[model samples]
Target: MQGAVGELRTLSEGDVAAAWALEAAGYPPEEAASLAKLQYRQREAGELFLGHFVDDQLIGFVCGTRSLEDHLTEESMDVHEPTGTTICIHSVCVDGGLYQKVLQNSSKTNSDRTHSSKWALCETEGCGDPVDGQ
Candidate 1:
């Protein structure tokens, strides 16, 4: 199903459940972050947690924590370093039916270095994989 037009914004506490839903749906259970882990990231590093909302509902998200480590590590993935310069992206999830639509809409703005640079050093893992069968 095609979602209504959406906008990208920093995720908030209100978005926790919706974000977790997409996370669990888009990844294998072993790869998905726990609901508690998602909550911790939202609380500790909200600035790094970006979500795509369609008609007030979350359809996609890119969530992570800030870290000093050059690459994603067990410590960086579990902890949010307030003063860190690197962004260890943990989840990049999109609804199964809305992958192409959401990406087309978000890419124009999100691909800009200036916008992404705000988060700094985005070390994304599995960002290239398709979340849906598409």
Candidate 2:
């Protein structure tokens, strides 16, 4: 949260670079997903790719693909199954500094609202079944 509350929305092709940047910065180099992978997610599973924006700047995101697998696995991470019913969330990244600020604010309300809405969208998409976070 900055001057205003952040809003969550579907990420599109245009948001890929920003999303990749946040991913790289939020996770260690070894754990970060490659730009190509992010690009693939944007192109193939755009519905599951969500960005948290404040003043139109991408600060965080949650991305994944639809899967029939019971849990997160190599295949789920690499492929998008449009007909699948389970969501395999690949990343949940937030800008480092902003994340700290939210913790300091000590209010779960904002974070909860964001996650709730995200899951709500997943449910609507018919892929709300939780798989282990990857």
Candidate 2 residue lDDT tens string, 17-121: 999998898777887889999999989988777777888988877787766666455677789877765566777777845654433232233233323222211
Model 1: residue 127 alpha-carbon error in angstroms: 11
Number of clashing pairs per prediction, in order: 0, 0
lDDT per residue as tens, model 1, 1-134: 26356678878898999999898888888888999999999999887677888778787887777666555667877899877655666777887566666555444444452233333222354332212111
Candidate 2 ranges with C-alpha deviation above 4 Å: 1-3, 96-134
Residue 96 miss distance in model 1 (angstroms): 3.3
User: Which candidate should be chosen as best, given lDDT against the real structure?
Assistant: 1
The estimated TM-scores of all candidates read: 0.73, 0.71
Off by over 4 Å in 1: 1-3, 97-134
Question: What value of lDDT does candidate 1 attain over all alpha carbons?
Answer: 0.69
- Winning candidate number (TM-score): 1
- Pairs clashing within candidate 1: none
